[model samples]
Target: MEDPRTDGAGSARREPEAAAWGERVARFVRGRVFPRESVLDGGGPEAAEALAALRAEARAEGLWALPLPAALGGGGLSFGAYAELAEAEGASDHGPAALGSAPLLDVTMLARFGRPEVREAYLKRLVAGEVRTCYAMTEPGVPGTDPFRTATRAERHPDGGWLVTGRKWFTSGAAGADLVTVMARTSGAAGDREGLSLLLVPTGSAGFRVVRELPVLGAPGQYEIALDGVRVPADHLLGEPGEALAIAGERLQLGRTLRCLRWLGQAQRAFDLMCERAATHDGSRGPLADQQLVQAHVFDALLALRTTRPLVREAVALIASGRDARTEVGLAKVAAARMLQQVADSAIQIHGAAGLGPDTPLPALFRTGRAARILDGPDELHITAVARRVLRTYGRAG
Candidate 1:
């Protein structure tokens, strides 16, 4: 007898092609790539080499640069398709970067504002994994949520060049990056947000220095960057002065979407692990899968996952359809990030003491989930924006 779930009646509910690709990626990672539990935590030159090899293999497999446009050697996936890939990669701790699947928040900015030559030179290399770049905007003393407080400065030199001077922190991927995309104040515009410009500075250029590879929570990778007179040709400037804020705004919107996609991936993995553990444990006399409380927690996590999936998908679709989803993207980011934290915490609860041990993946998953709330932007900030938008639309006083 034909199964009802496989018949034409259920064809409309078939899994997405993205899911199939995601499953392939997951299988490859679990079956072939990830080292055994003995060698998962530390970062070293050897780990870096292994990661690079994996990246090269992923690139070779026609899975490289999934977020990039088709003309640039990417899969030419729409936002929805790319989001699914991100979710898949996010399922494991190093899977995203190892697969060359880090969020390309500025891809839209590059497509819209970059010069033809700039796109050809930089974006093409980015797609090919020949170069890695990190964004430098946040400063040591400046409030991250306040963009107007940026202290980086760029002055036009007499010889048609620009000299940039600044210090930035929490610059992820900068340690191994070939280029740094810097935002600097280029003019004496009245407001803090005005007169900003984006510049591409090569790694070995004079006056550009990586001060240190920061150790965050004992994990190494993020870098502190110092631009003590970094000089670049006029052509290195990404867009006109005074347009940096707009570029950053657009990039953040897309970044939030990517964050949501990545978080969804991590949450999915955590939920799966929790369920597996629950089904097999015999210490409680009854399987955890049969516990009412455990079931409730699992159901809640699944509900959040189910809800946020569509929001993320919709945001991706809207972006691909040529609609700017700034506000919607923020909401999605906040929702997914908060939900991920809840899901991870619940998984830890379901796993009991095993969740706290380094041997289990839950601890690492929890750390990553915690970082998501602070990455891109804090959830409080997004909640504030969401509230303001709602008030303006529905408030009687308005």
Candidate 2:
């Protein structure tokens, strides 16, 4: 477990300091997070208490917010170094939040584009984990694949502010968020790409409401929300007007890459479970590991994990250097997601009835595996996008 250091050329190398930090994270995930999955996932006062205790422990152990800036009260790890530990940190669903890395994307976005007022109001608290935030970009009826078609609108008010109105669903962590970064049309029509903008909206606003929880595969977190003419102060806008798509694209590049790493971690966890079961669980003939079919499952899962890791790492290197990583990120996103799903399925199959039951983590892994394809951007979208980008190069040569 080494922290991956990047050279001047943005290539990954090994570093002892980073390795020690990465090991601390892996140990924390295994020692603390893994043991409390039931309580953390339970969703009640007890779950809240458990999570708070974990966060406090994480802070006490000096393992909190490793990827955020040192000026912002974090460990100040570069994205390159953090990418090495992300897989370990993200092995459990609660890892990022507990370790205070969950807010990296939003915190970074706000630090870069937030108005003085917005930053002064929330940035410190967000990094300190005093408050939580969620991003709202997906609309209820609009296809999330096309941001140009966003239906949410933010109209200019007489006072030079905004009146936002929209319905958004599948907004993760909205139920507990203190603030939300919403994507809305500021000028152009629904199909126009130029008018989308980012607005910072507090959940306590006059017209803000959480409609309901939209659980995925019986797991909680996602929510539907409504904004009925919510008044947002003029300075609440992120970056310039009509810059939401650009901001979101930058956010997603990192977001999707981190997600791919986490998916690989979870897939590796599932693969381990599958192997352990195969080696120990007796079958009709003998040990399941001896069976060719079970061996094939092991081989395939390992191969997927092995191949997807390098693609994800390559994307990480490109992003860490502030290069255009759209193609690399797109390829890694699809590959890692599919790898997770395939590996998790094989794990579940090896486990038989117990895998589907609540006794094992296999069920939860499988649930996330299924949803991974659709989240961020669906597999089909990534496939077409990557193919289009690749084809354009050949087109230019011709």
The top-ranked prediction according to lDDT is 2
Q: Give me candidate 1's TM-score against the actual structure.
A: 0.88
Error of 2 at 353 (Å): 0.7
The residue ranges of model 2 lying beyond 4 angstroms of the native Cα positions read: 1-16, 396-398
| Top TM-score hit | 2
| RMSD list, candidates in order | 6.5, 3.3
Cand. 2 Cα-lDDT: 0.89
lDDT of 1 by residue, 137-194 (tens): 8889877787677788889999988999999999987977888889888887424556
**Mind giving the per-residue lDDT tens digits that candidate 2 earns over 231-301?**
99999999999888888999999899989989988998999999999988999999998999999999999
Clashing pairs in 2: 3-19
